[model samples]
Target: MKFFKTMFALSFITALFIVGCAVQQPVQPIPDFSPTTFNSNDYVSALDNFLIILDASSSMDDRYNGNKKFVTAREIVKHLSQTLPELGQNAGLRSFGHSPKVSDKLTVLFYGMEEYTQKGLNEKSGLVSRAGGTSPMHTALTAAREDLKTFSGKTAVVIISDGQEAMGLKLPITLEAAQALKNQMGEDLCFYPIFVGDDEKGMHLMEEIANIGKCGFVTKADKLMTGSGMGQFVQDVFLTKKPMVQAPAPTPIVATPPAVEKAWVVGEAYFDFDKSIIKPAGFEFLDKVVDVLKSRPALFVKIQGHTDSIGTRKYNDALSLRRAKAVKTYLINKGIDKNRLSCEGFAFSKPVASNKTAEGRAMNRRVELYPVTK
Candidate 1:
């Protein structure tokens, strides 16, 4: 009886182990980030060259918030690539971990120290397949120092990692490497470290590395995954706001005839699908309109909102009105008199472009400004 009981217990234990091994944790889906188009007229590239250091060490295979850290890190790079405007800057991507199939080296430069393009960077980022091997972050940084040497301009070093290294390893080695890179690049080098996990030690390590660069800031992967978050990050890293030139003082008054009635369709301002918020790309056009309105206080302007024919008429009507009001509110906040502005919503009634194609739909979702003689 005792022997039978022992056999049954062993069988049960074996079954339990097999069940645990068979069940895999489901990875969460990364939310799609709608990148905002940045107008070149309002900003210029801040850095001449930039390098992205991604961590693909074995540790990244571990899951954080239901998704593998490696996947999240890769997504962050892709989204950043999409958000960054092609302003003729040099770019490169390096990975610390070895994917046995792709490379046998401890570190590899996957992409350019060449001119940056949204498509080119994304294709190279996709080439980094699997994550395996120890974190040799110091070695990657050392190679990156050499990578930066090939180009001359203000540069940014963006490191994306979980901040965890091999057990029993001394931490100072990583910092020393970062410091050395900084010493080589001098004031032109900035460090932007993106922490990928919730590990406290990892966060601190990433923060310390950024501190060493002295010119950049630290952010988390989850925050950068969002559309607005990535947009702000890109704006901070790559572009500097062009100084707003003040309108020249009005010339001594020569009596001018009443301004001819005019209408301006701000097709230059494009809206994201199903979104009503004014994008940064649209701000420059609106600011010019603000100058126009302020200069013509006697003119009453009508703000017209339109939308693509995707939703029901009733829903599109409300959406369009909300869009109109959004522009109206923006104008009011900019010190335009509320009494002079009126809003109207034309929901798919006016087709500036065909609703069948995406390009046409984007053009359809726009605001028009009409100035009337008071």
Candidate 2:
């Protein structure tokens, strides 16, 4: 009788363990925000011709967040190139760093979007040689404007640098030059100055330029590069209608099918704060998900979005959904069937880590994608 009791007790404990493993709290769904929609064929005055003027001055070699300014700028350009197709945009490249004299002429690394698409651009072969000097912001802008004159479509000039103008040209003068170009090119021409590193002077100058050019100003490099805010900004600038650009069309939302047996695949996708897009490093893990999907043809996955308990729940929820859908869209673009994937947002309700510290919050704000057997 004692042996029977022992066996029964063991079985009870085993059953509890199995039940514990099986029971999972339902993850709160993230709120979905309406995204902007635009007609693909409409001539909405898009800046199809993007001229990137990189400040390759010696000062750009300074380190920010453990990476050199020039290096970070390069990576940002590469990211834009890879992601531009999603927005139906294209870009060209030029730099002032190759000049031997501080006043030397700016070098055109890549002429236009067509060249960028056909030949491809690389740091070693395409970037201006590291013959560093002062930043000739005015010269670079003027040269870019001149190069863009022949092109008929809308044009945008983006300057990426630490804001130190090599030619000793005043910020006001540079602003005037950009404005003059805008006036010449008509209101369709936009100027965007992206200051690398946390230089107050450069940021201020960029703000002034954006104002004068009547364009958008992006200050926080990390945030501007990664997150939903950035995605929205891209949509506004390229896709939206009205005086303000509209958001991109929201991804389709599907109800969870009762017949499907779901299995959670959770992992953290890190991003710079106040941003909703994935970084280049995050893409490697996404590649793994692609591999898994390729191997398991019978399984379908649902992506759950989460965020650190920061901002209001409403905002977090919306941001989380955007991030999750962004991942799903990326996967689909890589050839995954759209029908096999579903995404939902959980916001800050599912906190895997404390939001008290930056590192913890980084871990908490992530997109979890797992397989479900239907």
Candidate 3:
């Protein structure tokens, strides 16, 4: 009887061990699909025509930060053209620096969006390689305006230049031509200038162009023209619905008494050129502000919007307000009190950084948050 009992006990123990092993089977992890399809067609599409005007002037040959400006611009244009879904929208390519004759002026490299049936950007064969001369930016603007004349949809002209109008055919003539074009086009078309270098004079020219064209101006290169910058630009233009403007750098935070009755958090949020909506990556930082407001139940925040010295002051001012309100709304949705927040737009009147370099302009486009404790 004892032997039989021992056998039963051992079998039971073995069975329990087997059950334990079965229960210990590893849990398979779910593959992350966020990065893969983050920008996929999950949201409603806002299709718009993109005209990429590249500055292929010899000056573009100059190294910016490290890479050649022209090369970086080409990479950005090509990637956006290929990756962004067709959505019934087309991309046009033009250049200002390459003319068979120095006087030929800004040449149309690729006219409008055509089906991409070729390999690479055809660097050696395209007008980019063939273009080497003075930059006729104004002429390029005129040509771009003409190109958009036929299309009735939303048109955006993206000029990627080093911001130097010095070597152009004639400065006064070009400026006059651009202004005339703007007068003819009215507000139907948008012009966005992405200055590549850090020349103050060049940035001023770009700012002038933006003012005349009533569009956004961006000066800077982020992360070597990888898809992120392009994506940010596109998102800013379409999603946020805020017109682009140049702004100043953020002011330093001043020390104040902790018992100060009230304070207002005011700041502007910067977006990619021609883009209005905030990128997802920036959401975390923005959310922190909301969290702070939630923690301080008695504190009220006022958001002030500002733009760099670009585009019409009226438009920038309005856009700045809209951008600030957008943030306020976002915070409200995140559980902050709407009544506690107020928004104001300052336009290009306030500038913290010189709008000369690409980096400086980026610093200009931002939202200011102030706390009001009264």
Candidate 2's C-alpha runs over 4 A off are 1-45, 86-90, 99-105, 113-125, 129-131, 225-230, 240-374
Task: Name the lDDT of candidate 3.
Answer: 0.61
| Candidate 1: regions farther than 4 A off | 1-24, 247-374
90-121: candidate 2 lDDT, tens digit per residue: 55677876546433555544445443352354
Please list the residue runs of candidate 3 whose C-alpha ends up more than 4 Å from where it truly belongs after superposition: 1-40, 44-47, 99-106, 113-127, 166-172, 238-374
Positional deviation of residue 88's Cα in model 1 after best superposition, in angstroms: 1.0
**Candidate 1 Cα deviation (angstroms), residue 313:** 51
TM-score of 1: 0.63
Q: All models: lDDT?
A: 0.83, 0.63, 0.61
Worst 10 residues of 3 by lDDT: 29-38
Point to the candidate with the largest TM-score.
1
- Top candidate when judged by lDDT against the true structure: 1
Name the lDDT value of residue 343 in candidate 1. Answer: 95
Cα RMSD for candidate 1?
Answer: 16.9
Q: What is the lDDT of residue 147 in candidate 1?
A: 92
